[model samples]
Target: MLKTRVIPCLLLRGESLIKTIKFDKYGYIGDPINTVRIFNELEVDELVFLDITATRENRPPNLDILREIADECFMPLAYGGGVKSVEDVRNILSIGLEKVVINSHAITNPNFITEIADTFGSQSIIASIDIKKNFWGKYEVLGVSGTKKTKLNYVEWAQELERLGAGELLITSMDREGTWKGYDVDLVRKITDSVSLPVIANGGAGNLQHIEEVVKQGNASAVALGSMVVYQGQDLGVLVNFPDRQKLSNIFG
Candidate 1:
């Protein structure tokens, strides 16, 4: 079996790095380049940075900032937000990123998924799907940084993204984000089981055991963290942190 990846999912609002809870209540964290350097030293398996406001603000990812991040990062990096056409993916890759994640665009213009995969190889395409459960407990796929709801169900969307040529899926729980209560294990399991592509579970990861549950019970191939690794205390003090390789080995191996 391939080793499971434990990735840090960083959120960018304009040029600043921030963290959110339940997909709202954004809080400033730290500089992106500085944080990337720390993660590089920690030797993280990979890194995912999403510009949470890019699409909503109608601007492309800040290439100048991303270029600076590319220079400091030694591990594989994936970026998303404000990506519209194949050209955006091409440019993001040229900046040394290994993959481009498509969320809102994937839902609005799915053919772009095939075009990007065909040009860049499916391995370079990551389909990002954000989901939230309603009061009635029905999971719904959300777009535009979890601001808009879509009719499609998470499982159906997962299968469609795979069929559309997405090599990987970044599945996030909008409700659980930054809460660190635990990952929505059953939600992860349901989506992972419905598709053949590698699924990266995100949101609500508070402890090492939570990581274990998402992989063992959720059957996720990888896990992504935000608040659990970025905050130091209840006050949400900004810190550059990550699980060391030994801790990761305990769960992944």
Candidate 2:
């Protein structure tokens, strides 16, 4: 991998792939297995699959579907959604996923992070933090797929997760998700500066410059691509693709 990781973060609705705008509206992308095959061919660094409906609908990790995905995925894979217990994390890793992203349960019971981290190891747990600007433009931490307000400051929460033994943080901007504007560098910077763990910046990214800005300015350790990798363009049709290898190497090298 390059010094900085550029990962495609795909969303899931049942077994089909979808892309969301601000965690509210969504558009169908394609089959999950088929999309993974394309990324494998592209030789991307990594892939992240988050089931958007899992937590909202009150379910567990769709192991059968995820099993298929893990079997087909050639690159290192991580998954989130409906992971509520240490067993959930255990089963997910048993099936071949590299890490588990915990959100709702992490808030309802902060000790869950420690439990999973202790049981499996901190490197197996990823704390998924969804952040959005309220009407007053104040950043609020969200849980349950960005539905419930946790009323916790993201930087403080990130530090807490780091203390609780989370290996990394997947910090996504709900306000910028699927907008193709760019990442919330200010918000991300605060979290990165506050925590020692690596952070994967998500939501908003139109092109290579956007990616460069987040890593260079925001101090992000990695980036997660949503629309930039799944769409042909802003309003264009769906296309399973990644950036050119040479361009990515040049940007980070």
Candidate 3:
């Protein structure tokens, strides 16, 4: 089996990096470039930078910022938010990003996934599914920064994305986002069982054991976290109070 990956998920509201709770209550964290530089020094395996407000605000991705990030980041980088076309994917890839994550665009035009995969290969594409549990206790797709709801069920959409040629699925629980309580394990398992592609579980990761639970119990191929690393402000140059990379690798091993 491939070794599970531990990734830091960064949210960009604009030039500033922010964190959100339950997909709401956005808090300014720091500059993206500074954070990326710190993570690079920490020898993180990968980084995901998402512009949380782009899609909600109906604006295109900030390529200039992305270019700046790409120039600084040594690890593989994945970018998403307000990406809607094959041209968008091409432009992002051209800027040295390893993967392009499509969320709202995939729902609006399902065929876009195949087009991207055909042009850039499936490995360059990541289908980001933002999910929220409704009052009835079923997970549903939340678009436009978790404000708009789509009728498509979470599992069904995930399976369809893989069939449409997404290389990976980034499953984030809006309900658990930034709560630090734990991951939505049941939700993670449901999505993982429904698709063969690697699933990166995001949202509500508070500690190292939470990471273990998500991987071993939730059955996720990888885990992503935010806030836990940035909240303490130990030092902008070093890793804060998150799991040690060597220990996490051992746990996954």
Which candidate ranks first by lDDT, i.e. highest?
2
Best by TM-score: 2
The regions of model 1 sitting more than 4 angstroms off are: 234-236
> How many backbone overlaps does candidate 1 show?
0
Mark the regions of model 2 whose C-alpha exceeds 4 Å error after superposition. Answer: none
- Alpha-carbon local distance difference test for all models: 0.90, 0.93, 0.88
| lDDT of predicted model 1 | 0.90
Model 3 regions more than 4 Å off: 233-242
Clashes of each: 0, 0, 0
Tens digits of per-residue lDDT for model 3, 49-159: 999899888899999999999999999999999998888888999999999989988998999999999999999998999999889987889888888889998899999
Per-residue lDDT for 1-253 in model 2, tens only? 7789999999999999999999989999999999999998998878999998999999899999999999999999999999998888889999999999999999999999999988989998889999999999999999999999987988889999999999999999999999999999998899989999999999999999999999999999999999999999999999888988789888886
Q: What is the TM-score ranking, best to worst?
A: 2, 1, 3
TM-score versus the correct structure, for each prediction: 0.97, 0.99, 0.94
